[model samples]
Structures are given as structure tokens and as C-alpha cells.
Target chain A: SAVISQKPSRDICQRGTSLTIQCQVDSQVTMMFWYRQQPGQSLTLIATANQGSEATYESGFVIDKFPISRPNLTFSTLTVSNMSPEDSSIYLCSVTGGSEAFFGQGTRLTVV
Target chain B: AQSVSQHNHHVILSEAASLELGCNYSYGGTVNLFWYVQYPGQHLQLLLKYFSGDPLVKGIKGFEAEFIKSKFSFNLRKPSVQWSDTAEYFCAVKPGGSYIPTFGRGTSLIVHP
Candidate 1:
């Protein structure tokens, strides 16, 4: 299993402000993914961050609202732009190794 | 599109009681199944996974799951429950050769002491 860490474990921000969450992995990985978990709900895939290229976002999500950047194989960042109250959720980063996948501690963002 | 469904949303059980949580996927082709647990205030942890070969797979903390291909079901079970087992359980499925997993809504299990 890989040791994954995310910066800003928990943050409270005013509406209209943006926050970038950072994910760092202990080892290099090919694919890194971002997911959002609403309060009392299942996780929704936000996008797949590819190193040196634009990320592939899922349906119901767009890059303009949730921009992602992967500078290298072991690090990625997700910026929630123009945040609102509805944007408050737990953001998690994941990477796959072998047959299993591992997740970071997750960043809990609350937009007031 | 691949999707997973967990029948129970919340389950309450007393200590030493048996536990079962149903999970079904909407894929007819080959798939990999997994069960994950999330304790309060912690990240999700893998319980067990089934890729191939064994239909009945055992996992940590006296937990096990059986994969019934025809029914597209992989249900988690434990003979006895403990208060420490009170947490959220999530079922996930990945297609034949896909690395991405689709997760279920998750089931909240509460074991009364």
C-alpha cells in the first residue's frame, strides 16, 4: 500500500473564495484521481489527473469549476474555484498500485 | 455504465449478533469485487477483495464475502458482531480489466454494546 497525504486537512473558507488541495504520494503512480463526498452521501469522481496533460473530468463536473494539475507522477492538486455553500464536501485523492487502490487522508472543505 | 448497489442503508445489531450486508452490481461481464470499511473519523480501508478463483473469500476481523456471479452479488457477512465493528461499509466493483472502481452508496452498521 502507498502512503498518501493531503494538505489542509480541514479548512473553512468564505464563499466566492477558492482553495487548492494538494495530494502527495509516497511513490510514483500513473493515474491519480479526485473524488468528492458530500455530507451523508457516496463519493463522486471529480476528475483523473494526468501528469503533463489536462485532466479528464467525469459527467456532471467541469474543469473550469474544478481545475486540476499534476506536475509529476507523485503529486497532484485540485482547485475548487469560486466556491459556494454547495461546494462544501470532503475531497479525496486516490492512486492505484497493483490490484488495489489507496486514498489520501482527504481534505474537508467547508464554504461558509 | 457500471454501477454498484447496496441494499441496506443502516443496520443495527447487538453484540454477538450475526451480520450481513447485500451488494449487487449491474455488470454482466467479468468484474472484480471488493469490500471496504471506514471507521469514524478515519479513511477507508480495504476489508477484502475477489479477483478470481475462490468464490468464498475471507478477510480480516472475521469478515467474509461470497461472490455469486449469476446473481451479480457479493455480500459481506460476519458471524458475530462487536461494538468496534460499528462503521460504514462500502462495496465496490471494477470491470474485467479496468482499474477504476465504482463504489456503492455504503451501509452504516451500528453494533450496540
Candidate 2:
């Protein structure tokens, strides 16, 4: 399993402020996934990040709102641009290792 | 497109009670099933998975799930419950050969001692 370190674990930001969450993996992985869990809702895939390429965003997500950067195989970042209260949710970074997917301790974002 | 469904939104049980949570998926092809648990203040952890072979698979913490291919269901079960077992459970399915996994609305389990 890959050990994924994500931060900041919890944060409070103004509605118009942007916040960037970083994910670092202990081992190199081919792909990294970003997911969002809204309060009282299920996990939804935000995008799939691959090294050396642009991220593929999901239907309701966009690059301008949720920009992603995958500089290498072991590190990636997700930036919530122009925050809103609806953007407040738990963001998780995951990597597939072997047959299982390992997750990081999610970043809990709160936009005031 | 693939989607997962978990029948129960919330379940409450007494310690030592039997437990079962229903999960279903909609996909046209073969899939890999997974059950993940999130304890309070903890990250999601894999409880079990079913890729192929046996339809019945056991996972960590005395948890198990059965995959019924014909029914498109993978229901999680535990013979008995413990207070420490309280957590939220999610069922995810990835179509065979696909990199994306679709997750179900989680089921919140509350086990009272």
C-alpha cells in the first residue's frame, strides 16, 4: 500500500479565497485520484491526475474551479480556486497499489 | 456509465447483533467490488474486495461480503456487532479494466454496547 500524506488536514477560508491541498506519496504511482465527500453524501471523483499530463476532470468539475497539478509520480496538488461554501468538503487523495486503493487522511475544507 | 447504490442510509444495532448492508451496482460489464470503512476521525480502510473466483469474500475485522453476479449485488455482513464497529461503510465498483471506481452513498452504522 502507498502511504499518502495530505495537508492541511483541516482549514477555514473565506468564500472568495482559494486553498491548495498537497498530496505526497511514499512510492511512485502511475495514477492518482481526487475525490470529494460532501457533508452527508457519498464520495465523488473530482479528477484523475497522471504524471506529465493534464488532469481529467469529472462531469461537474472543471479546471478553473479545481485545478490539479501532477508534477511527478509521487506528488500532486489540488487547488480550490475561488472558494464557496459549497466547495467545503472533505477532499481525499488516493492511489491504486496492487489490487487495492489506499487513501490519505482527507483534507477537511470549510469555506466561510 | 457506472453507479453504486447502498440501500440503508443509517443502521442501528445492539452489540452482538447480526449485521447486513445491501449494495447494488449498475454496469454493463464485469466489475471489481469493494467495501471500505471509515471509523470516526480515521481515513477510509478497505474491508474486503471481490475481483474473481469466490463469490464470498472475507475481509479485516471479521467482516465479509457476498457478490451475486446475477443480481448485481454485493452485500456486507457480520455475524455479530461490537461497539467499536460503529462507522460509515461505502461500497465501490469499478468496471473490469477501468481505472475509475464508482462509490455508493455510504451507510452509517451505529453499534451500541
- Best-performing candidate as measured by lDDT: 2
- Return the lDDT, model 1, position A107: 92
> Tens digits of per-residue lDDT for model 2 on B1-113?
88899999999999999999999999979899999999999889999999999999999999999999999999999999999999999999998888778899899999999
Candidate 1 similarity to native, TM-score: 0.97
Identify the runs in model 2 with alpha carbons over 4 angstroms from their true place.
none
Relative to the true structure, candidate 1 has a C-alpha RMSD (angstroms) of 1.0
The lDDT per prediction is 0.93, 0.95
Off by over 4 Å in 1: none
- Model 1 residue B76 CA deviation (Å) reads 0.4
User: What is the C-alpha lDDT profile of model 1 across A1-112, one tens digit per residue?
Assistant: 8989998899999999999999999998989999998876777899999898999999999999999999999999999999999999999999987778788888999999
| TM-scores for chain A over all candidates | 0.97, 0.98
Q: What DockQ does each listed candidate score? A: 0.68, 0.78
